[model samples]
Every structure is written in structure tokens, then in C-alpha cells.
Target: MSPKYDDVRNSLLGWLSTGLREEPSTAAIFHQLCHRLVDYGFCLSRSTLHLRVHHPQWLGTRIIWVRDQPHADEQTVAYDVEATDVFQRSPFHRVIHTGKQVRQRILIFGPHIFQIYEELREQGHTDYSAWPLDHSQGRRHLITFATDRSEGFYDDEIALISDILPLFSLVTEIRLKNQLARTLLQTYVGPHASEQILDGATTRGSGVTVSAAVMMCDLRNFTQMAARRPRDEVIAILNDYFDLIAEPIERHGGEILKFIGDGLLSVFPLDRPDACDRLMAAVTEAYDALARRSPLDHQIRFGTGVHVGEVMYGNVGSTRRLDFTVIGPAVNLASRLEGMTKTLQRPVLISGDFVKAANCASRTEYLGNHGIPGFDDLMEVYALRIDAELHAR
Candidate 1:
């Protein structure tokens, strides 16, 4: 091996660390790396640079980035989209087909792959090497290196990337999967979601304990709605309903605990008492939600209940099924009030305790004391008028 090779390799390593440290996105890092590699003669002169990224839900640690420099005309947006599609399926179909690590040389730039090559040329790259990369955090990514010169990545180049590929793939996969799963959770719980649930972050708000507000909401007749409607229609209606109701919860400082079947449990002041005001905002939101979404099959009505009191709150659950939850009387009362909405013939109901807790300005008509089945007292309740109070909700 040439002595110069080590210098070039070392240079590449040092240069690549900036990407690792700052993590300036895969594309920006690759563009810089490719330019430096070419300038140092690792790549042929005048070669273009093109790169792509793909992540799957199994590989953790590194991101997969694919690099190729095709003819100028070939690097269209459509071409890149196709490359991403290939990256997504390649791990399942091709890469993983050979085991945890797979490497091979193929004439991917031939006439059969001309459009791909053209895109590389359009971007100024002529050689192509499809290598998958991964990083810690469970994200599976792809690094495809392509250049304008004939012949693709050299043995040493391949060796360097090959050494890191497996670990990177594992990392990328894990990160990707975690992110995807988090996205799913947020979608289910609504925008006012917890970092403990979505980002896996946890820290105490303060050592001192404080009172908080908890709110609960449920579709009045989800079982009947699903039984009567097709699945697609149900999903469409649900999206609309959630969009209407969940936004206001998030607009204020509320954290959605979980989406329990058709019911949602959410808490305010989980982070602190600032969320107390959010309960009222949630009331306004729920009160007006049915109107805009009325077009998407208005037969479904929702019952929402809010209660304010003290509770211990934080991230708790099984390691595998960790949940950000509030487990105390307040949450239970909020849930029971939601159940009462059905008997009371009201869509939006709040405990007088919650209204006083929120210091709300809106009209809050009280419902006489009535006992809940489990807890002893008739929890005093108030129903927020739909059009009057929640325009800002």
C-alpha cells in the first residue's frame, strides 16, 4: 500500500469527525467528504458527487447514506425519489438477504441503469458504490458513493466503509425504528404528547410536589360507529376528529397520556401548574370541535371531562412499554366525569373544581352534586356552551 494512502485515509477520518460531532445532516457531510476525497485524488478529477440516505427500523447506531455522481441530466428529483425507494426495500430484500453484512460489485451504472448513471452525471459523478451506513440510535442508513470517473470505490475505500457498515446499519436501524415508533405514538396520542413517551427523555420538573389538572375525553359511541361504518370511513373521520380536538390541548401546555381505545387520557401540570390553564382551553376545544368536522359524518359526538387536584406524575411503566402517566384520584375523577357526559346529555363537561382551578372567564353552568360509583361524592360539574366559549379553544 502506498504511504500516501494512510495520509488520505487519516485526512478523511479527521474530516468526517465534524459530521459525527455536529451531525450536520447526512447530505451536507457527504458533500463535504466527497469534495475533499476527490481533491486529494481518492476519486478521479472532475467527478460529480451525489449521495442519498435510507433508514430502517431495525438497524441502530449509524445512518445509511448512498453516494453516486451521475451525469447532470440524471439527478432529477424523480430520480432521487426512486433511489430512496430502492434504499428502503434494499435492506429487506437485497442487503439482509445475505445476512448482517453484504458487499458485492455490480455494473449498476450500465445501460440498464443508465438513467441512474445519468442522474449521477447530471450531478457530476460517474462511479457508483451502494453502501449502507448506520449509527447509534437504531437507524439503518445507506451511503452510496458515486463519482464521474469510470470504476467505482477502490478496495481501500471499500475496506474503510465495510469496516464501519455493519455497526452503522445496526445503529441506523434502531434509530429509524425508534423514530418511526415515536411518530406512531404521537399520531395516536395527539400533539400534546410527552417526551418520555416519544423522545424517551426524563427529568424531574422539581423535587417539590404540586397540584395539577387532568383531562379525559372519549368518543361517545366509537364501538357503534365502527360497527356501522367501513374501516376507511372510520379512519378518515377519526383523523378529522383528532385534528379538531387534539390541537387545542397542545396549543396550551398539556401532555396526552395515552389513547385508550377510543378514549384519551391527558394531563396538565405534569410538567408544572402552568398546565392548569390548559384544562379550560381543552374545554373550549372539545366544545367547538364537532362543528368544523361535522362534515365528516357528524353522528359521532365526544364526551370530555376535566378535573383539577394533586397527583404524582412522571414516566412509569414496563421498560418495553414505558408510559408517561398520572395515576391518582384526579385522573380517575376526570375519567368518571367523561363517563357522566353520556347520562347528562352534554358533550363538554368540567368539574367545578377544574373551573376554579383554571380561573376561567367563560360561562360554567353547574350540575348539582351527584355521586360517582367508585369515589364517594357527587362531583360538581359544569358544561361549557359550544359556540359561546371555545372559539379560542
Candidate 2:
């Protein structure tokens, strides 16, 4: 390598090492690297990088950098292992299967190997190169570079980039691992809880007391459904049932704390003055939303309890295991009310405090004072009547 190439080599290593110390979005890193490569006389006009990830919705992300653009663009695609016709004829797919580095000249008039080559030639790009890295786990990553210079990249330039390809792969793999951790965390737990866990609130008894509106929802007849249904059918039923309850809660800015068998606990934090109104509206919306999806035969049924008060929210468990959730008078009362739905045969029950805070007492019917287990006073409760057909269903 020439003496000028030495500086490029050092700079690439430095950038890759810096990734270990600080976390930046993958697009930002790729954009900076493209600029650096251009300054080093690599003559890059466009560059694209691809990494397949383990995710439910997305197959992977593609980061593209174009010269003169302010930043790189990242696009995600759904998982599709079956290669399409376009992919079958492309250099990227060939390189991955052959485990080789490909360098081709994009001729302006002569027959082009791929449609992209013809397009690049029309855009003044003279050379194209693709490098594919195949891992043992049947995953592959590819990086492609295009240059608009009169002459394609020289043999020495290609060798320089090839020598540093491993470093690029290492840095990219670390970023992907970080992305996977966040994706999985957010998938399994609510986003708020994921943030808490990532922020180091993992120890037992690390909790905070906060005032909020609490809701507990239980699927009616779920035990019967699970007992009589096949295993797969039972699992599917539970998933659909949870979605009916969870979708509206999250849509209205509530966070689900935990799922307890056929029941789920959710909360709307009281950080604003209108928090009560928002919570009450959200609970009502949840019922209507679920009812629309309910079967006419009344095969699926649920009951919800809404209350407002302070509760301890956070980690609680043994040293080896812990659960991040709410536990207090408010939470207990909400669960108890949910259980009452089976006795009273109502779809929803709300506390007097909720009615007062929401300024919606007129809209709710007085259900009289009710006694709760493990509580001294008889609590005043209210009920929101839904369509008779919905309740029967």
C-alpha cells in the first residue's frame, strides 16, 4: 500500500474502535465512514450495506449512502428467505452464495451483467464492487461500493478495502447485537418497563409510589375455553383476547404492568391534570373496541375494573427472580372489582373516586356501596352499562 493509504487504514481502525466506547445509530456511523472513504480518494459515489437480523416483523435493514446527501437512509424489509428473481440475478446474491468478492466494470454501451450496472453506468459510475461476509449460522451480510471516476478502482484500492472488511464486520455485528437486545426487550415487556430495566432498576424492592388510574381486566370463561380447546387453539385464543384488551390501553397511553393468567393489570399515570378524564375515556373505548370484535354467540367475554389511587410500582421478588408491577390497595381493589363482574354480571365497574376525578358521575349509574375483602370501609362503586347484546355475547 502507498504511504497515503496508511492514514486511511489508521482512520478506519480508530473509527471502528470508537464504536466500542460510544453508541450511535448505525446509519450515522455508515454515513461518516462514507465521507471518510471519499476523502481518502476511494472515489465513492454510492455505498450500500445490508445485515439480516432476528426479528419478527423485519428481515433486516439496508443502509444506503449517496454522495452529496446529508445522511444515510435506512430501510427495513419483511423476512423472506426465498430469493426473488431480481435477487437471483444480482451480484449481491451471487457473492453471498459463492463467498467471494466481486469487482466489475460498468460499461456505458456494452452488455451489462445486471440492470443496476446499466443504471450505474448511465449515472457516470464506472466501477462496482461487492463484498459478502458469510457467517457459520447461515446468515450473510454484504457491502457494495460504486464510484463515478473515469477509471474503476485500482487493484491496490480493492485490496485495501478487502484487508479491512473484517473490522467493518466486527463493528457492525456489535451494533446489530445492541439492536436485537432493545427489539426483544420491547417485544416481551411494555416499552416503559423496558426502559426501566435498561436503566438499571433490576434489583428486588426497588419501587416507587405513584398515584394513577389502575385497571384490571379478566377474560370470562377462559378457564373453560382452555380446558376444552386444543393446546394450539387455547394459545391462539389467549393471544387474540389479550390483543383486544391491550390495543386500546396502549393506544390511550396506558402501560400494561403484567399479565396474570387470564387477567392483565394496566395503569394510566397521573402526571397531568386531565389524567382522570383520559383514563376513563380509555377504559370505555377499550370496552367498545373489544365488543366490536366479539362473536355474536358470546364465546369471548371480559370484565374490567377501573380505580384511581396511589400504588407501589416496581421490582418485587426473591434475589434470583423479580417482577416489575404494581401492588397496593388500589391494585387490589381493582382486581377485586374485576372478580365482582362475574357475580353482578356486568362488563365494567368504576370506583367513586374515578367518577369524581373524571367528572363523569352523571354518565355512570350508582351501583350502591360495596364491601371488599381485606378493606375496612364499604366503597361506593359505579357501573357503565353496555348494550344488552354485548353483555350476552
Candidate 3:
């Protein structure tokens, strides 16, 4: 390689090493790398990076960079993307599965070789090449480069890119691992709890007492539904039910701390002035959404109990396996109230404290004070008047 090419390679290596230490955004780093290569006189017209991420809703992510574009474009690959005909017929599949490089001179390949080559040829690209980006534990990703220049890439240019790939892979692995950690945390625990764990709140039994509106929701007849139905069908039903209930709660700023079988526990922190209002709106929206669903085999029914009080919120469990969740009488009360929904024949039951905090007395029907287990005095309970409009204040 000439001095100019050596200079370019060194500069890129320095940048990537800094990126590994700084942990910059993956998209920004990739976009900068592509532009730098172009500025160094490599005839690069387009480049793409494909990453297979460990996520619940997505299979992978694709970052596309076009020459002269100010920023790169990013798109998430869905879980079913691998099964699509387009992916099955593309060169990416070969590189990803075989852990090998693919080089195609677009002008020489017939249309039947690969659909991607045909597309590149139509876009005036003369050459296409894909390389397997290997990471730790035998995982493989993909990177591709295309050039519109008549001569395509020189032998030395390709050699330089090949030599620098290990450095690029090292930088990317660090970022991707961090991203995967966050994704797993957020998936298993709520975002707020995940942030707390990430911020070094992992000690067992460590917690804080905070005032908030808490809710417990359970699907009715779920045990019986699971008993008779096929396991796959039962799981599908549970997912659908959770989606319907979980979306509104998340949209209204409630954090779901746990999904216990067919039920979930959520909270709206009182730090926000509208916490109680948001809880009410979220429950109402969830109920209305579930009511609209018309399942073929059975009807969907659920019970919700809401209360406002102080609870211990943090990590708890054995020394080895700790769980970040809420505890104390307030959470217990919410659970008991949810159980009462079946006896009272009400879809939603609210404690008196929640009604006062939300200022929704006019919209609630007073159910006389009732004796609560583990408490001395009778507790006042109210049922939300479903006919009344409930929305965020």
C-alpha cells in the first residue's frame, strides 16, 4: 500500500480505538467511518452493516449509508424477516450462514445469480462484496460495500479494508454487548427498574419507600383456559391479552414491574402530579380495549385493583438471584382488592385513598367500608363508574 493508504488506515484505526473507549452510538460511528473512507478516495458509493441483535421484538438491525448522504438510514429487522423470500435469496444469507466472503462483479452476473446483484447493477454499481463480521462466541454479522466506479475497488483497497476489519469488529462488539445488556434488562424488568439496576442498585433487600398509585391486574378464567387449550394456543392467548393491557399502561406512563402468570403489577409514581389520573386513564383504556376484542373460542375478562400508598420499591430475593420489585402493605392491599373484584362483580375496584388523590369522587360509586385482612380498621373501597369518562387530566 502507498503512504496515503497507510495514513488512511492508521487514522481509521485510531478513530475506532477511541470509539471503543468512548462507546459512541453505533450508527454515528458507522456513518463517520464510511464518510472517512470516501474522503480518502476509495470509490465507495454505498455501504451497509447488518447486525443480529438479541431482542424480543426484532431479529436484527440494518444500517445503510449512501455516498454524499448527510446521515445513515437505519431499519429494524422483524422476527419473521429470515423466513422471507428476499432474505433467503440474497447474498447476505450466504455470508451470514457460511461465515465466508462474497464478491460479485455486477456486470458479469446474470439476473438469476442474486436479486441484490441485479438491483446493484440497475443502480450503476459495478461491484458488490460482502464480508462476515465475526464477534465473540461464534456469532456472525455482515458488512457489504458497493461501488459505482467502472473499475470498482483496487486490490490494495480491498486488502486494506480486510486488514482493518478486526479493529472495526472489536469496536462494534463492545457497543453491541452493552446494547444487548440493556435490551435484556428492559425486557425482563420495567424501564425504571432496569435503569436503577444499571445505576448500581443490585444489592439484595435494598429499597426505597415511595408514595405511588399501584395497580394489580389479572385475567379472569385464565387457569381454566390454559387447562383445556393446547399449550401453544394458550401462550398465544396470553401474549395477546398482555399486549392489549400492557400497551395502554405503558402509553400512559405506568411502569409494569412484573407479569405474574396471567396478571401484571404496575405503578404510577406520585412524583408526577398526574400520577393517579394517568393510572385511572390507563386502566380505563385497557378495559375498553379488551372489551372490543372478540375472540372466537372465548370472551376476554379481567379484574383490576388500584390503590395509592407508600411501598418499598427495589431489589429483593436470595443473595444469588435477586428480583427488582415492589413490596409492603400497599402492594398486598392492591392484590387483595383485585381478588375482591370477582366477588363484587366489578371490573375495577379502587381504594378510598386513590379516589381522593385522583379527585375522581364524582365518578366513583361508594362501596361501604369493608374489613380487610391483616388490618385493624375497616377500609373504604370504591368502584369506578365505567360509564363515566376517564381520561388523563
| lDDT of all predictions | 0.58, 0.81, 0.86
List candidate 3 stretches off by more than 4 Å: 108-112, 295-297, 387-393
Model 3 lDDT tens row, 51-167: 989689898899999998888999999989889999998998899889888988877545548888888888889988899999999999989999998988887788889888998
- Assess the local accuracy of residue 82 in candidate 2 as a C-alpha lDDT between 0 and 100: 32
Against the hidden true structure, what lDDT does model 2 obtain? 0.81
- Our model 1 lands, by Cα RMSD against the true structure, at 7.2
Write model 1 residue lDDT over 184-224, tens digit each, in one string: 66655544343444453554331223477887888767888
Worst 10 residues of 2 by lDDT: 384-393
Candidate 1 Cα lDDT to native: 0.58
With a 3 Å backbone cut-off (N, CA, C), the pairs that clash in candidate 3 are: none
Residue 290: error of model 1 in Å? 2.4
Better of 1 and 3 by lDDT: 3
Off by over 4 Å in 1: 10-114, 133-141, 148-210, 229-240, 270-274, 294-298, 315-324, 375-379, 388-393
- Candidate 2: regions farther than 4 A off: 81-102, 107-126, 133-140, 227-233, 293-299
> Residue 344 in candidate 2 has what lDDT?
72
Candidate that would win on TM-score: 3
Candidate 1 vs. true structure, TM-score: 0.65
